[model samples]
Each structure stands twice: as C-alpha cells, then as structure tokens.
Target: MDESLSHNDEAHASSSHSGSRRGGWITFPFITGALVGLTLAAGGWLSNLIVFLIEEFHVKSIDAAQIANVVNGSSSFFPIIGAIVADSLFGSFSVISISSCISLLGIIVLALTAMLNSLRPQPCVVGSELCQPTSTLQDAVLYTGIALASIGLGGTRYTLATMGANQFDKPKNQASFFNWYFFTLYSTTAVALTVIVYIEDNAGWRWGFGLCVLTNIIGLAVFLSGTRFYNIDKPQGSPFVGLARVAVAAFQKRKLQLSSESKDYYDGHDGVKEGIVTGTLSNSFRFLNRAAQKIEGDIRSDGSIAKPWRLSTMQQVEDFKTIIRILPLWSTTIFLSTPLGVQSSMIVLQALSMDRHIGPHFKMPSGSVIVIVLLSTAISLTLIDRFLCPVWQKLTGRSPTPLQRIGLGHVLNVLSMALSALVESKRLKLAKANHLQPVVPMLALWLFPQLVLAGIGEAFHFPGQVALYYQEFPVSLRSTSTAMISLVIGIAFYLSTGVINLVQRVTGWLPNDINNGKLDNVYWMLVVVGVLNFGYYLVCAKLYKYRNVKGADVNSGSADSEK
Candidate 1:
C-alpha cells in the first residue's frame, strides 16, 4: 500500500513539473483567439437568422422567431451531451477539434444556400400581394445546415471553456479564466451583432455566411496550433455509470442495516488500511450511505467488491449526495433563464415593429439591437471583476459567495423584466395612438435599458453558477458541471417557446404582429414569474450547505451559516 501511494505521489509530482513547463497562461492566447474566432462565426449567422428566414425564405415573422428559438435551444442543450461524451469517451480536445471541423462544414453549407438561388425560395417582389412558400428541397437544405451548425456549436462552445480551465491548476486562476472567457465570448458576440449584421444587411447574406466559414476555418486552425501547450486530461470512463451503481447498490442493500462504525463501510481500498476516506460518514443523507456499508461476503479476498450492485465506495456515495443537494439550487436557474429566453425572442419582434433608424443614413438591423445585452454584459463583467469584487472584499473582509452573486442577479433579472414591461407599455401606447401602423415612431433604443439590465444580471449569475458547479461537483464530473448551465439555458428556451405558445393561445398578448398585440402583458407576466422564482431561489440558497467551501474565502460569514 505504501509503495502504491509513493508511486502515485511520484506520478503526480512528474505531472505537476511537466504541467509547469508546458501549460498555464502560455496557452491562453491561442485558446482565446480560437474562442474569439468561433464566437464571431456563430454569432454572425445565429443573430441574423430570423431576418434571413423572413427575407430569403419568405417565412412568416412568428414562424421565423419560433425557428430561431428552437435553434438556440438546440445549440444550448447539445453541450450536455457533448460534455458527457468528453467525460466518458473522447476528452475535450478531441471533441472540440472534431466539432470545430463540423462547424466549418456547416457554415460552408449555409453559405452555399445563400449563394445558390436554387437552394432558396423565389425572392419576394416589392409590393407583392403574396409570397411563394419554400419548396421541400429548400426546407431540407436549410434544416440540414441549421442542424449541423447547432450540433457543432453544442460540442465546442462550453467544452472549450472546460478545456481552458483544465489547463490551470489553481481555483483562483480557473475563476479568472471564466470571467475572461465570458468577456471574450460577449465581446466577440458584440462584434458579430454590429459588424457582421451590418455586412449581412448591406453587403449581402452570402458574404456574411462566407465570412462565417472563413472565421470557423481560422478558429479551428488556431486551436490546433496550440496542441503542445495544452495540459489535456484523459477520459475517465463513464461517471454516470458510477452514479448509477451507487443507487443500485443502495437499493440492493435496502434490507440490510447501516453500520455506525467506520470499519463497516467500503472506501475503495484495502480493508485493513482504512481506505481512501479516513473520516466518519456524514450523517446528512444517511440513507445513501447504505450503498457504502459492508456485509458478510461482500468483499473478495483481494479487497475488491464481489458484487458491484451490492456495494459501492464512500466517494461514490458522497458524489451522488452532492448532486442531490445541489439539484434544487440548480433548478432555480432554469426559471431564471426561461424568462430571459422569452424576452430575447420577443424583443427582436418588438425591434422589428419599432423605428429602427438611428439616423437617415443608418437604420439599425433588428438583430444588432440585441447586441446591447452583450455589450452591457461585457462591460458589467469588467466592472464586477475590477471594481465590485475588490470593494466587496474590502468592506466584508471576504469575497462574495456564489450564492450572493446569484441572488443579486435574480434581483437584477426581475428588475429588467419590469423595465421591459414598462417600455413595452409605452411603445404599445405610441402604436395605439399612431393607429397601429406597420411601424411605430418609437426608437428601438428604448429597448436598450432592459437589455442592459439583463446583461448585468447575466454577468452576475452566469459565472457564479459556473464557479459554483465546477467547485461543488465531483472531480470526475468537472466537464459535466460546466455544461450544466448550457442544459439550463437549453431547457429554458424550450420552456420559453412553450410559454409563448400557451400565452398566444390563451390570450391576445402575442399575435403574429406584436405591435397589434398586448406585448407589455407578456413582459409583466415574466416579471411576476421572475419574482416567484427569486423567492424559491432564496429558500434553496438558505437551506443549501457548501460541501467544499474551505479556503475559498467565500464570504466567511456565509460559510459559517453552512455549518
């Protein structure tokens, strides 16, 4: 046993020495550049998709919005699957490399659709009474491009963040990387929203999509160039299988009594050596500890468990409990994200109906208007990291906990929804006074404050959630932890779609033309929902205890509460 531990120590020391020489901040530039290129490519096409569908495909405005929502949802949701694959089969490097290539292909296909007249419906004539619908072939080609792009995005986006974080050994460095990761992400998105959207609106759709293809190729190349500098982690087989084993073992031992003595539980090592876990089992969730309890004949002569379903290691048991404990807190984020998804989709429709002109020469593209959120988020992240965190540390003598940041975000989110409600009400009043014309006289800039507030809210919660999950989740599930936010966003977008559909069917809040509908009421409903969700989040935060808060300096007062 001593020899085995010494070998492990030597291997770890060697790995640390190698890591010091190759990885760390040295790899940041290449990874950051890759991230910027990928974001520019994705944001360019995704942001302008609704407009593309409406103008090129001749789809109805509402249908285009719904399609855009689905695409966004799919892009967000697929990361969970990608993360699982990275954890269980291929590591993040291989998955990211393959996914980037796939994205390049997808962008090329999309560019072809834009350049080829045969791939799209006939252009709608000005002042035409009716527009021709897209044929089956056109629809198939369009969907194929979208599917490929979404899958590619899902596989690469968050996985890259995980890989980048893995390169750094320190938790503080990992946290810093997350802030910069999001900042870079939003900054590139802002460029795409303004510059790329302008190109699409002015130069043409084909040029814009061609640029996406070019950027994707460049990004993939840059990422590949940094291969030697990255400290890549190996796939650790399936963590989910281990989790499942814990549950199965617990059930199989349901009839057996749980032992009070430390010697009675399996700890994934030699029975006489006291095993990996030296301490007494945590009394909380004692029911799950049954899985780790040892019974007669449960262990082989070699100290391996004879039946996998009848016994589990204490570490496995604790990992399962950690997931169970965090689930309620995790669930609150879904509702928080759902309303934002609804607002994002609905806001575009609002911008479409409002006066989009900033000057006689410059009419704002509706897609680019949403960039206000990204811009605000980028700026807010800088402020939070540079200013707010230091002030918080000075005043409180400790940094704000993840829960505190998330709570503040909840407040900001509710306020943003209320602001949106108010803005929409004024816009509706203006439209009603103008006799519900094709376009209202109100400037689309009126929407910026709500978007900015939402952005600030995101700056607070998004990274906080990422940090919380990455810290709390078991080491084996680190990639899965980072991808959890993507899963929440994806589910929320789908729920947003459902909520919008339900609202349209039950009330007059969302018509095909939002200007003719009670759009203000939708925002108000979101505000109400946000408030309720915030209340639920507070309850969960109050009850939840941090499993790994030591040395984190997470507002020691808050840490004390967990005790």
Candidate 2:
C-alpha cells in the first residue's frame, strides 16, 4: 500500500513541479520561523502562569494551580474549534494569520496587566498571612486577558501545523516537516521555560510578558511574509456535520428493515464517496445500515442527497461505525493524562517549598522545575524513535503496536505516581520534623526521578494515541484526527481539576499549605487511579481490533525505519 501511495505521490509531484508553484521546500524557513517565534511567545507566559497568579493576584497556591489547569484545558480545547472553523468556514492560512494577531493582542493585554497597577491586586510577600485578595473587577480583567491569550494560542498552533503539512505532496517531505516543526516547537519552548521564565522570575513580569508580545508580533509578521509561498487549501465543509447526519439518519430510519443487497443502499452519486464501502455497508452495527437503505424522497434526480438528515450514504454509515468502534480505546487515554495534569501542578507547588538553590548562588524558579519533564520527554522521545524502537523490532520481529506502547506508558505512569508518593511522603516527614517550615530540608532534585518517568510515559502514550487516531479515522475525518488527542488532553486537564476539587472537599490530603496536609496520600490515590485506568486500557486493547490494518502496518514501518 505504501509503495503504491509513494508511486502516486511521485507521479503527482513530478507533474505538478514548477517554479511558479506556491508550495515546496522554499516556504520552510518562513513557516518554521513563525512557528518558533509564536511557540516561544506562548511558552514564555504560559509556562510561568501559576507563579504569576500566586505572586501578582494574591491567590492561594491550590487555587492558582486550578486556574492554571483551567487555562491549559482551554488552550487544548479551543484547537478543535479552530480546526472546525478552518474546515467549515475559513482556510487554515486565514485562521492561522488571524489567530496570530489575536495572540499578539492578547499578549499585549497580558503585558499591560503586568505593567499597570490597576489590573491586579497589590503585591504581597510570599506566605504572608495578611495578603489582600483580588477584587471582582481585578479578577475579571485578569481572566479576560487569560481567555484571549488561550483562544489565540489554541487557534493558531494546530492550524499552523496542518498548513505546514499541506505544503508538500510527498509523505517523506511531510514527515520531515513534522520532525523539524516539533523540534522547533519543543526546543523553542525549552528556551522559554528556562530563559524567558528566568526573566519573569528575576527581571519582572512586565519584561517577560513584553517579550511575549514582541515575539507574537514578529511571528505574525513572518507568517504573513510567506503569503505567496504557501499552498493554500480551500475550506471543505466540516466532516463532523456528515457524521452527525449519519447519526440523525440512522435514528430516523431505525424502524426501516435492514437489507443485505447492494442495490438496497445509497452508494452515492457518480461514484463519488468517502470510504471504501462502495456497494455494501459493514455487517456490524446493522441498525445504522438502515440509514443507507433506499426510501422515497431520499435522493433527487441528480442523485445528490435531497433530505440529508433522513438518509446518508453507505460510506457515511460505515464511517460512523468506525468511530464508534474506536471510541472506547480513545476514552482510556483521558485517564492516562489526568494524573499527569495533577502532577504538573503539584510539582510546581512542591518545588516552591523545597530547596531550589544550586551551589548557593543561583536559585531555580519554581516554574523552571517543569522543564525537567520537558527535557526528559524530549530526550526519551529521541531515544525511543532512534534506539529503543529498533532494538524492540530487532528482538521481536515487529515494531511495537500503538496499544503496546500505550500500555507500557500506563504502567510507567502508575510507577511514576508510586514514586511521587514516596518522594512526597519523605518530604512531609521532613516538614513535620521542621515544624512545617516555609521551606523543607529536602532537595527539589528528588522530584526528578518521578517527573522523568512521567515524561517517558508521555513519550509512549501521546504519540501512540495520535498515530492510532490518524490511522483509524475515516478519510473525511482525517484532518480532525490529530485534534482528537488535543481533545483528550483538554478533557484530562478538566478532569484533573475536578479530581483535585473532590479531594479537597472530601479529604484533608490537600490544604492551603500542602506541607501541613497529606499530599502523599493524593499521589497514592492517583497511583490507584492509574492502576485502575491501566486495567481498563488493557481490556479495551484486548477487545479492539484494528480497522485499518494496512495503515497500521505502514505506520509501524515508518516507526521502524525512523533513524
């Protein structure tokens, strides 16, 4: 299948190649520059946002973490909306361009909140008992800035990625583009985590946010400069609408008798269809097959759909079934990320009360501690792609399946939670010994092993989910497949927020001062959650069968061949 597709792409590229054409390697620098600048700008403010909320807004530590999680959820969730808008109304280029400007405006607003005294509560010393809480108006302004920034950042990032991938015809070129794109994204983000976050901690929030604003502007400018070089695809109506039609049609036709004859179904007009189901629908989910069963007024003289809500094509019905079959597996990933969300926030809080000093001169920012996870993920991803995968294939005679990878990730995540429990228990004991002092005697570096393990888990699961969705989803929904992972992550963050709130309400494990509470118990709870979630994943994996076996094989080949 891959050989055939490669031949087709080569033929298409050779015939289409011309100096006058818009897309190719020529647009790489401009697009990559825009990506770097925007990603750097996003990370600059977002990476240290919990610290900003705690220091500037006089919010409680737990509340700040919750707010940050909400912000992260919003950022992750909005991409699906952006992708929808791009597919249904505007093109990717327009959406990306407009979104970048919005990000610039949002960052400018953020910079103002940092610069102006009126937008936030008065600064108070850390751990002060008499710190003033923010007023309603102050909260509104701060939330407005965060909302805009989240919307803008979410709108552009993934849309820009799709646009970059669309620029090349060859799979290899598109694959290479993604490699560089992620490299730029992660590397620039690492810089922001370190350099930009250090500036925010040392120079001032105003300076850090000001740099974000500048980069947003530069990134927008660079993206716009590539106007003539991009291969812009026109908006096709949302594939989701088609899926909805299938569900509606299926329900409306629920009473209709099912049929096995090819002539009984609407195979579509002029042989134009969305899936491999040309003459018949799949036997599974036979109730939906009635959706394609011919009835009066279902089609017009031209063979186009007359009442689309009442009747769908065979392909649409099959496509809907494909999604239904894959949903359980997708659901298991939400819990996979929920624990990480909790850990991300909890680690920052832990770092704040631990020894962050190195050699007694340089104090690491609490925010910078998360960078260890990022670095660990990056390093682990490289090793998995370069070394581990090959070794596994050589020893096993086949590359690891996505389910295998995700299962490994689940086990690692559970182990990381257990490790986190141990670390926190030690810290809590030390805090008790010291009478719950502001800073414990424990070193912040003690958190690294758990974080590194969590990062490695992500290296396995996140990409595995993405690859799974892309391979399994119907052709019409291919563009939206990548966003499915984002949706999972977004839901995970929100679920984590809910979990934290529940723990706070029901248990004394989480309090205003974590040192005084049983934070280790929270990690132990998450470990249990992880263990249960992993069991659920295993069940789902055992029940699920690959819908696109050929595609999966190709993906495995690509993974194996990656050097």
Candidate 3:
C-alpha cells in the first residue's frame, strides 16, 4: 500500500510539472511583440527626423543617410548577437532589459539636445533659405544624440521580437497568433509613423525627438515592470557556440565520416541509429555539434586551410550568405524598404526645396506632413488588423497571405516612389523657372502617395513577412535568422549611400546640388531596383516552402508563424 501511494504521488507531481511547462509557451508571442512594436516606432521616428534634419540643417542627403545608416546598422546589426545571447545564456528578459536601457540612454541624449534647441528661435529664416547653411553648436549635439539613440534601438531589434514570439507553444494556435502578432507591430507603426512625426514636425524637431525619448523611457519602464508577466525560457547556453557547432558540422561532414570510417554511425542488424554528440539535441542538432567538433579538430590538426571554408558566424548571420538561401524570396522586402527609408532622405529634401510656407499664416514643416501620413498609417493598420484581418478570413476562408501582403507592398513602394519623384521633378522645374521656391510645396501633396500607399503596404507587408522569417529560423538560430533579414534593410541604406557616392565619383556629380538633386534620375534608379526585387521574389515563390516548426515540436510551437 505504501509503495502504491508513493507511485501515485510521483505520477501526480509529474502531471503538474507537465501542465506548467505547457502553459508557459503561450506568453512568448506577447513578450517579443511588445518589444518589436517599441523598436519599430523608434525606427519610424528616427527615419523621419534624419531626413528633415539634413535638409533643414543644409547637410547633404548622402551624409545624412550615412549618419542615420550608422544607427540603423546597429539597431539591425546587434540582433544576431542578442539572439545568440538569448538562445544560449541570458534568456529573453535579461537581453531585453539590458538592450532597452542602452537604447533609452541614447534617447535621453536626444531629449536633452531637443530641450536645448528650444532656446534658439529663427522662424524668419524658415521662409527664406531652402536649407540652414549653418546650425548652432546645439544642432550638432542633437544629431549626435539621435545617432546614439538609433544605435541603442538597433541592438534590441531582433532580440525582443524573437523572445516575444517564443511564448506561444501550440503549432496551430501559434500560426494564428503569429499573424495577429505581426499585425500589432505594423498597426503600431501606422500610429507612430503618423502621429509621432506630425507632433514633432508641427511643434519642433527637437520636441519630436524629445517625445520619442520620453516614449522610449516609458517603453523601458513598462517592459521592466512587466518582467514578471513574461514567459522566461530556460537559457540553453551560448547560442554563438551552438551556431558555430552547426556550421562546423555542416562544413566537416566528410571529415567526420572519414575519421569514423562510417563506424561512428552504427549500422546494426536492427537498422541504423547514429551516434549522438554531447550538447546537441536532435539529429540535425547533433550533426551540427559533431561538425563543430570536427572543424575545430581539423583547425588544430592542419594548422592551415586553403580556401578556408571556416565561416565567420557573425557576418554569415548578417551578410548575404546566411540569408542568401531565402533572398530570392525575401528580395521583395528590399523593394519595400527603399521607399520606406526614403521617407527620411530624398523626400524631406524635396520638401525643403519647395515653398514650405502654406497660406501666409502657416509655414508647414515638410517633415511634419510626412509624420501625419505615418500616423494615419498606424490608424489604418489597427483597423485592418483588428477588423479587416478577421472579416477577410471569414469571407475568403483564408487570412492575408504573407506572399500576397509582401507583393502588394512592393507594388505600393514603387507607386509611392514614382509619385514622389514626379512631384519633386515638377517642383524643381517650377522653382528653377521662377528663380524662387515653387508657390506651394507640391511635395506636401505628393507625400500622400507615400503616406497612403506606403502605409497600406507596411500594414500588410512589414509585420506579415517579418513574422514569417522569425518562424522559419531554427530554434537556436531564431534571433540570428531574423536579424539576417533585417540587416539587409540596414545594409541597403549604407549601400545606397555608397552607390550614390560611387555614382558621384564616376560622373563627378555632387549630391544635393540643385542640378544633381534632379532626383528624377535617382527615383528612376529606385524604380529599376524595385522592379528587380519584385522579379527576385517571383523566383523565390517557386523554390521556397513555408515551415511551421511548431507543428513539428511542442517545444517551439511558437517558433514559426508559417502558413
């Protein structure tokens, strides 16, 4: 009787533990999502401000792009590192807390700079010069503050998003949740991109950045305070080491086989059961672990390698190679980002060159108009996600497909760029002919194309596709994989600047000069790139297949938000 009672007690305890473990995963999506929304809002605000500042401050667009790109790169670049840290050691909560604080400090600097700028006022100059020829020392301070904040923002980009998605554990439910989760991110942007920008531009750029800083502070506080609400996963160990191991296994497959002489993988009368390595989970997991060991052993043994197949996991994670497998499909994202990024650079320049004085009584800040458009996007996103997504699912018997949303957005990106280019081209001709700024900033009205089309595209594309990428990455590599996709956008910004500089070098064209700012040509360049990206996606559509990792393993039901 005593033995039977003990067995019953043990069974009950096991059941309770199993129940707790199962329930824990549901929180993953919410946690990662909150962080993603916060970071994306900051991204939109920064992208908007950077453009206006360059024009208003009379700096070159290429220079401004480079500065903003620096922060953009960081915000994107750090995700792989954060993913590795999160997957292996720190866990999601610690990673988010640390990264959010880093970003928060950067925002504080910007807020201070904004507060300082409020002291100097010169509205009279607003209507006269197309751009500020010189900024007070305080202006430089503002730029630096914004840049630092962008860096902080970039670092947390991937980590929090990944962490949030990890909470939902059911494959089917996880699938539905992912769609909803992405919707939240884009919807929030529609709000931030529009409302935040409008307030900042109408009030003051400093005030705009200052508000962002305050918002970030609130985000940080909310995140930290809600720490207890999070589903803290068990820390696996150094995710970098794990990734390295997988790379090693992949690279050293032949070597390992030769050394084992096919003996390591036992071929028994009952069939085959491969020898598993330590610190590895499943078959693929072990293969990776074993590969890492073999690679390390080879490195130690040979002392030299020709063509050196050793992959730098860091760069591999961010550069073309790691993501190249998916690039053909993801090419669409590149097209979408160009117009999205332009909301800051060329767009703002066009606004500056136009007649910004509206109706004698109102001098519209070009950047402010762009902000309103973005805020409108946020509202639209909310309506669509909350209402449209559900209603569409009921009517169509399917939700918004990632590919459809992505393709639609790409189309919109092109339209926005094309419209803006035309408006800008006309404004330039008018200004040049009159020997004065155009009667009205046509660019203001042209912003509608970007505001409306771009907003709609983002509502569908940004969140939908990003959620897909996160879902597709392997458990250990989830964060790193997501970072890989995001880095492309960041890299593209840097690349755009380089490309512009290269064009300037080859043709001896100065950027932002009235003659060179004949951006109709550059807009054409974007059009060509956008079309090519669209073509790339078509190719991917044929070869790519969606993987819902959650369906495969209860451990990561929230892993891939696949169709």
Steric clash pairs (candidate 2): none
Q: Each model's TM-score, in the order given?
A: 0.90, 0.94, 0.68
Model 1 residue runs over 4 Å out of place are 1-21, 170-176, 270-278, 554-563
All candidates' lDDT scores?
A: 0.84, 0.85, 0.55
Maximum-lDDT candidate: 2
RMSD of each: 4.8, 3.4, 8.4
Question: Sorted by TM-score, highest first, which candidate order results?
Answer: 2, 1, 3
TM-score of 1: 0.90
Give me the overall lDDT of model 2.
0.85
Candidate 2 versus the native: TM-score? 0.94
Candidate 2 residues 1-563, lDDT tens each?
24434544455466554422256677789888999889989999898999998888878999999999999999999999999999999999889988887888788888988999988877776666887778898887788888888999999888887888787777777777777777787788889999999999999999999999988888988998887666777798999998899889889988887776788788787445743546567789888888888888888998888998988888888889999999999888999899999999999999999998877799898898888878887888889988987899899987788888889989999999999999999999999999999899989999999999998988888777767877788888876787898898899999999999999999988998999999899999999988898899889999999988867956644432221
Q: Candidate 3 lDDT, tens digit per residue, 93-123?
A: 7877777777677666665645653522333
Off by over 4 Å in 2: 1-21, 125-128, 270-279, 557-563
